[model samples]
Target: MNNIVPIPLSIGNTPIRKCDFLSEYFKTNIFVKDEFHNPGMSSKDRPAYFMIQDAIQRNRIQAGGTFVEASSGNTGLGIALIARQLGYKVKIFVSKSCSQEKIDKLEEAGASIELCDNSNGLQDFQSTQFRAQSFAAKEQNAYFTNQYYNTQNIRAHYRTTGPEIWEQTDGQITHFLCGIGTGGTISGVGRFLKEQAKAIRIWGVEPRGSILQHYLKHRTAPNAVRPFDAIEGIGRNFVPGSFDPQPIDQIFQVEKDVSIDMAQWYYQHTDIRCGFSSAAVLASLKCYSAAMRFHSDDNVLLFFPDHGSRYLSKLYAENSKVSTSNAHSLNG
Candidate 1:
């Protein structure tokens, strides 16, 4: 009798596949974890599901209550879907930077929408987060799913995603890479991998304009941090409470243009359309290649945050006009 564990095809159990195309091109064992398999089609589904459950377990909310949150897109949509399914009303505050597709989906999931100017480079991104808090304060039975500050954000990944990767990879993962946002995913997963093997390298990828790298160096966010550069969920002008930089081995920043090109290249070669931030992780690996520390046999996994459907209006709108040939070459 076989003792093999059947792979789960459900939320929080997305598949991790070794990419032969990427491994061949990069001359290393490159694996891509497809978070799009989640019901919300993104890694945000994990936290959204976990946080809401946390609220219920702790009596932070009850049936027919209201859920409140601020999101660039994925988190809000995830909450909206969960809240709707569990008989709760929801309100989502979004930065102008959020794509129309995400907003439409949030509405379809029965979320009352509010707009914040922070995402449009008008002010600090925290404005949206604070706005949601204030709104939740004045509303009846409104439980704020403060993803940015809530420790539950990290707990979600630590409890579920971290163990999933360890078990799925058979405890052989050598490196864990992903884009940093609220800092929950990397912090939770990175910390977990570190505990399993202190030798595991945790590399973080950041958008060029993101202040996370700046915060890591200066221990403070800049007063005039650059706004989201056409990519959502990865770049942050303010350091979120969920962000924990302790487990990160290195942080790589990539330009938006190059990240966009690589995302398309990945799709053309693999038929897997990933979100822009996830593409940034791919570009980060290219930058890491120059260091030449990674061996061909090392198992390196890149965590893709979400799917491309949420970014269709922006990142994938004119995909054909861009070519990856000039994007980033091993020689260059």
Candidate 2:
């Protein structure tokens, strides 16, 4: 008989494949974890599964209740996937700035949606999250699964993503590259990798508009001190509670066009189509990896956050031109 056992989910434990384009560009063996293959079409599935499962065990939530939260896109999909499977209701609050495709997908999944107005010059998701919190507090049998502050978000990456990378690479991973959104994914994964091996370098990639890169560079920056970036799911207007700066070796600020180009490159180069932030991460990996002279003894790993399906309007617009309107300045 075969020793392979049945797995519960087809999404995670995704392929960590070597990137041909990136490897040629970087002159190093660069690998991308195809997180877009996840059920929710993003890496959020990892944390969302653990978050919901742990919430159930800890009695933080009960069945048939409403799971209320704010999301740029992917996290909402993750929660909706579990909510539908477990017979719960999900209400997602999204900023008006999020892509239209994301809004449609959440609704298609039977998630109730509230669109927040960012026309008043208020920061994007912060306004939405605030509204969501208020709504969750007033609603009956509602639980707010705050992805940003939730400790389970961090734990998810630590237990699953980090160990998986270490195992898949046969402990040869010298550098880990990813974009910081809620801070959960990178923080958890970086912390775990550092604990397993002290020499591992964890580098976080953020959009140029985000403060994370500036924070890493100057330990602080004006305006950017608040997590403000345009890329969905990977940049924050505020620092998440779960993010720890200690384990990070460096930060790279990626331009929107660079990310857009890389995302387009993915579709052209590989069968896999990934989100904007995923492209940003890979582009950053290419740039960073190329600078380093590594032998077969070294390894560089990059994470592809979500699928490109959610970003068709922005990244794969009808015209050949990709929009750069979302790009903001970190120094401002």
Candidate 3:
């Protein structure tokens, strides 16, 4: 792998594995997309690679100019990885709540980091986004690549992610499940899959407190509001501009412990180790497959969003209360 030059800038050819544990318990076939193999250790690498490529092609990024954006973790890592190889200066604004390990990785990738709202304790996603915007506004050469509003993020999924899944599954994919963050993964992939086969079921996984599930169930709500949850990388105070709510068949809200347990169990049982979002997705998949009892031959696909390595100190460390308690509860 070291001999390969420039790494070819491609997303992983992730495999679909039938979950033996889940199949026995639920009496149905269950499959997962192992996104941890992607370059940046998460599915976000797909969009990050393409987003930078598109920016270069369109001349949105001047030669040797600095790139700037804000992200929770994976997106920043994605941008920083590409910028380092391409010889561009990069700075990423991250929320104060983001893991220190992620910040260290970003800095290691040659990115300057700005901590957003560190003093005031702005833990909310919307507040952090607002702070990122405020910082972006003052930078002279900074390009605020809004992942939430950017069509490129969706286009990345539409052109690359969706095609890869469709081809990999050999058109046998009957249901799609993903952790919804920016809605790019769901919107783009869902659109393409629907266009290819209208029978496909697209479900978005949200944190327990997220409004997306509620919004999908009841479109008549007067206004959207933000709620706090332990889950990361999915759900926002408001719907992203890139989010297309119509194509979503269902939105499943998962508990924090459920996600933590699922991720830990996967790492323990399988070779794949992914972030909490992946666990939420697996939990959702279990629930969905159990209720629907998918046909014996039918294929059900779940997207494992990001790797859990970045969450080591918090999710993997012995001193980390969340993982310890979650493990205890699961044992109980």
Candidate 4:
């Protein structure tokens, strides 16, 4: 809806509302920034818009030109959505491990798909990211909007999302919880909030197999790391260039089963239809709630990255046994 930016599509300024059920249990406010309101129905829309607009402004790309990016799912869809709006062509090199629904959505958005080798759902051997970069370089007039390394990714969230949250909470937010993917969301928003008030805690959630948690603890990646393909797009084997570790307070490593179970609970019980990685943040809250300092009046906000609809096949499939009988509970 930006006239000056040449994008007439609706994006950003999503709602921040309290999760009434979760708030009652925690004895404090639990707010979720619903990024589904974006034109692409995901938080990725913010950066996608910014990066594309930036490329256009710099004359690195032109109308009707091909726009390329390597994404797990949502980011590709964001670019694809915007590219179509601006009469640009999109080619996405996505992860082979991503859900079928994501692949279908990308095609629907007019993005040509290239499924790259994501060895066991983690980065390995000329990954999707590198493929996009190489292809963009070789292709005529093609620009690779690399979300992993793009500073515009962080700038998008910092300039818009962070300010929105701060204003929405009236600067009373005590904790900000988010899943660390490319590290842009948490890093950007966390830095902005910290600049405003250093007391505001920024907590990142990482899937069990991700190297980010290990990297944070020891300042180095493990020699051998396990692959976590259960959930798409929330963890990284190698730390991304966009990830600024200085703004992050701490990170919690979560399990795939628990994350999926939490997303399932939201689908069946709550009004919020959270994706796998968003549920990872919720699971982190459940697991680490006791350790955090929670006061009655504190506002704890969650950055819900996307809706659960795109994950129906993976998280809520008939054969998927990720959920236990007591999967819904915050208690162990």
As a whole number from 0 to 100, the lDDT of residue 65 in candidate 3 is 72
Q: Which residue pairs clash in candidate 3?
A: none
Could you tell me the TM-score of candidate 2? 0.85
Q: Model 3 segments beyond 4 Å from truth? A: 1-8, 118-126, 219-226, 286-290, 319-332
lDDT of 3 by residue, 78-183 (tens): 8888777877778777777788888888888888888875211124444556656665668665566667777888887888778888998889898888988788
Ranked candidates (TM-score, high to low): 4, 1, 3, 2
What is the TM-score (0 to 1) of candidate 1? 0.90
lDDT of each: 0.81, 0.75, 0.73, 0.84
- What lDDT, from 0 to 1, does candidate 3 have? 0.73
RMSD of 1: 5.2
* Model 1 residue 157 lDDT score: 90
Candidate 2 per-residue C-alpha lDDT over 1-332 given as tens digits, one digit per residue, 9 for 90 to 100 = 22221223554787798877767655667788878778877888887777777666666666688887778878898889876778889998887888999999899989998888631112443476777778888988778888877898999899988898989998889888888877888889999999989998888888776766666666654462443446666665456676777788888877776777667655655656678788788667645554555655457788888778888888777533323442222101
Per-residue C-alpha lDDT of model 1 across residues 126-230, encoded as one tens digit per residue: 567778888888988889998988898998899889999999999999989999878899999988989999999988888887788877777787888555555
* Model 4 spans with C-alpha error above 4 angstroms: 1-4, 119-123, 319-324, 327-332
Model 2 lDDT at residue 165: 91
Q: Name the lDDT value of residue 204 in candidate 1.
A: 82
TM-scores, one per candidate? 0.90, 0.85, 0.86, 0.92
Cα distance off (Å), candidate 4, residue 31 = 0.6
Encode model 4's per-residue lDDT on 68-158: one tens digit a residue: 9889889999999988788889999887788898899999988999988762222554688878888898998899999988999999999
